[model samples]
Target: MAPGTAERIARLIAPLRVKPGSRVDLARDFDPRYKGPLKKKDSAELLAVGVTLLAEYQQRLAAQDTYGVLLCLQALDAGGKDGTIRHVMSGVNPQGVKVSSFKVPSAEELGHDYLWRYAARLPARGDIAIFNRSHYEEVLVVRVHAEVLDRQRLPGDVRTADIWERRYREINAWERYLTDNGFRVVKVFLNLSKEEQRTRFMKRIDLPERNWKFSAADVRERRHWDEYQIAFSEMLSATSTKWAPWYVVPADRKWFARICTAAVLAHTLTGIDPQYPTVSDKARKDLLTARRELEAEAPKGAAADPYAARHRSAGG
Candidate 1:
């Protein structure tokens, strides 16, 4: 049976409250109506809306100075998190955008609370903060590698089961607090099939430079794929809420993944406009005069670079 467009859109907005230590199916509820190989035209069409929404969101961030957008992106290695961020957010102004790739926490970071670095990196008023992998890792990685807790030195009171649930409750409450304090959260779990991941892993092995990216951990993690999926599904169901929704993006096709992600981001951000700052009437008059003065000095008859040459230089 065919799912209607309305039903598909509803899925996009639906909140997921995935539980801690459990997997969730945040994969796309893709419909044929919106599924197609992403060609240049399709990408451009998606970008048009993305650019506009980003501009609007930028304005709101600047004006409200209180509201922010916290976009959390998580996926297996090579799930295209970096690429998606690059392509989908290509049009966003660099000044208003901030990307944080949370790798292994530093020795100093280990000294403070788990969220210390995270709290420091939270988007300022009128900013968009992107977390490549977020505090969720404290749950995922810590659970997968129990030794990681040795570094955290958590209070003795936090038993394994109690700690996991506490962290889940803490995250939910934290997100709710942020939303109430003027922030919109978007969590995306890139859904890459095991077969697709195997293909990517093979590519890394076959290519010379890519060999460096392959690790024992990759092989190790594959062993736990089922557990991770179960964990992810539970996480989505427990954490997915109306205030901050989760988008399950199918990632078999990298290009399509970028398009769909950009679409969702644009959809969410369009409600708030991020406009270029306005100048006063007097400032505008002065700026216009300065522009006219500069234009007057333009050399009229000079030979310009050939279109082909310009195009070549610009394109490549």
Candidate 2:
């Protein structure tokens, strides 16, 4: 993490959280004085701070071999989950990061249990896993269009009213399970207003390159926007636990939303207080012995070429 790289990263992510014509007041939620673009200096400063904290988090994650999760960017269409991931995590160590994007389930997927893939996708110890859109879909998409669930033929004992409640209880217990086992869960709902989504939809239609983003089905879903919101709000209220809290991000102003998200994430990671594992004295002595032997037998050209070095990475 360079002096200002974190800030620049923050600027890049800022646009993903909120766009113009947003129904929510994101800037005001963070600070009413915040206006348009995040200046280079400010963004740079933010990134510097953000990266330092993430480095600490990465160290702690590795040392403790703890798993952490960033879950459920639950929002309407164009809520900026992709953007948030791209920008907010730019400062993180990619080696320990895994991202999963959940979409419409295939026939085979429908046949198995809903949690099947989710369980397999869980990050291993010492890793961070991000869910672009997650299992919450079972609640959101299923509730809005029962047709989707009808295909799966849910358990006969599952009642209509009890289904969602069961999920919420399972979600909270699951989060607590993770925490007790050394996992952290952070759920964020990108709360964008209908007005903002419409503006972005129109942008996709009007802009030549962005035209591909528009879909006729998206307009159809917009009609049920109220239903989705109620489901989302209810989900947030019911599942916002002490172990895993849900943050309500204002999705009106993209920059403000990005900053606030960064702030919150930074806050969470910092709370983990990760520290790099210290090398043992025995290991240090062994390294010194190896270094002495290497130095004694080393040739001038023993060092590798820079160009060849570029192709191979430490991860390999």
Candidate 3:
């Protein structure tokens, strides 16, 4: 990798990372429309480079078959999570990538433990799995709307005052366990501003093609913006651990957000340092023998007049 490329990637990611144990105040700590030091054109160019590098790294990761990457994206409605995934991850080979979008859980999912539905979607070794919205919803949306918990039918004690804190701890421990077991978790929160969200909502409402995306419930949820903000801030402060820190990317500028996401992923995959597996001496020897046999079977004089006999037989 070029040093300049590495530096660009570092700059793109540095401002966004919420270090472990660091308190996050959302309003004070992050900007929803930040574009860093790069101009729009420069940011676009850098993102192209970063996306190419990410594709290369993903290929090596798949070939090594020794590590798994889990990318978790969390955001409010119309926050561009889908756009980030589409544009940033477009270069990667689909066979090596799996994307699971978590929505309202089915009755069967609600019957299991909160984490059970997510556990089954984890990436296998040599693969990258992306979660459009992930397990964090348990703490974010569920925390903001306590009534959702009533559906869980948990014992009163289990859903007591300390439940949020307990869930945060469990999430941190779960992420630590995943890191210890060869999975690298990259979590991103697309920090979209309320004003930007309203603009997007209007576009969804007025545009014929996007009408299907507009929902009355989205407007209903926007009424709780402050509550969601508080929930998100608390979640970030509590769960951004050493093994799996969160990058709160500014989402108002869709292009810049996409670039930030691509840069973070490129940087993370580079740190993993995946490579093609080395061949053992015995395997190398077998390859050599196979090569020799293939070479030995080459037709004599083919190089000088490869298709001469065929042409003559056809009376050309």
Candidate 4:
């Protein structure tokens, strides 16, 4: 990382973040087509740099094994969440990252509290976990269509008119608890314009390769777009806490959205600043002894090891 790169990234994303306690009216407050001063041509190079930074930080994070990161992504259909994940995380090692996509609740999941399934899938120490449409779905989707709550099996007393407000507070507190326990929660909402969403949907239908991505149900959900926007606004306002604030990434342009997403994640890991663990004195001594023993046994000629000459030529 270059000097002040982290600070630059922080500045780049400051405008996209939802400040804690701020009221959000998604349509009025954020422009889904906003790409700042960067043009489409700049995305590839910016994203490459972001990927390199992510890879470096991820290695240190894994080696340190002292903290975890959870990325919560929320988006409407055709909002580019999948593509954002694919491009932003392309350079990371698969072993250290887990992506969990949450759909409608399964019978088993509905049997437990709404957060149970999400909590169970949290990242282990030194790992990153991404939730595609996460626990916030409880507030967004269920709030949009209140009838979905009928299936949750909640106690009658708990299903009062103030249920949404209660859930918001509970979620904020839960995120605070995670932050205290060495886990950082990152939230992003892909803010896509209604026009852009329709355009993407048309492409999904017109292109054979993308047909599988389209669903009639997705189109059906379009009818409730206004309601969903309201739910999303409320969710952002209520849960964008200091511990886990939300970034509203403009999703009208896929390339711009990807780079912005990358910046947000890179900024996060940069702040955490995880480092490779330092060995203790006893461990260092054992390492020296092991090195000596290995050196004493390694007497093979160039002919014995096929790559010995190559290693020597490369100064290995």
How many clashes in each candidate? 34, 7, 0, 0
lDDT of each: 0.71, 0.70, 0.90, 0.92
lDDT (10s digit) by residue, model 1, range 1-316: 1235334433443432233444444443322123444475566665565555566566666666656888899888778898888887776777878999998889999999888888888887688889998878877777767788888888777756677677777888888989898787878777788888899999999999989989978888899887776666666666767676677777777766676676566555654434456689999999989877765665786324345556887899
Where does model 3 exceed 4 Å of error? 296-316
Pairs of colliding residues, candidate 2: 6-47, 7-43, 7-44, 7-47, 18-253, 18-254, 60-274
- Tens digits of per-residue lDDT, candidate 3, 248-281, equal 9999999898988898888889989899999999
Q: TM-score per candidate, in order?
A: 0.75, 0.78, 0.92, 0.94
Top model by TM-score, which number?
A: 4
Local accuracy of candidate 4 as per-residue lDDT tens digits, 187-212: 99999999999999999999999999
Residue-level error in angstroms, candidate 2, position 13? 17
lDDT of 1: 0.71
After superposing all C-alphas onto the true structure, candidate 3 shows an RMSD in angstroms of 5.3
For 148-264, candidate 2 gives per-residue lDDT tens digits of: 878887877875768888887887787788888877777777778777888899999999999887899999999998788678656765776767776676666665566656665
For candidate 2, the C-alpha RMSD (Å) to the true structure equals: 7.2
lDDT assessment of candidate 4: 0.92
Q: Is candidate 3 or candidate 4 better by lDDT?
A: 4
Q: TM-score ranking from best to worst? A: 4, 3, 2, 1
Top lDDT model: 4
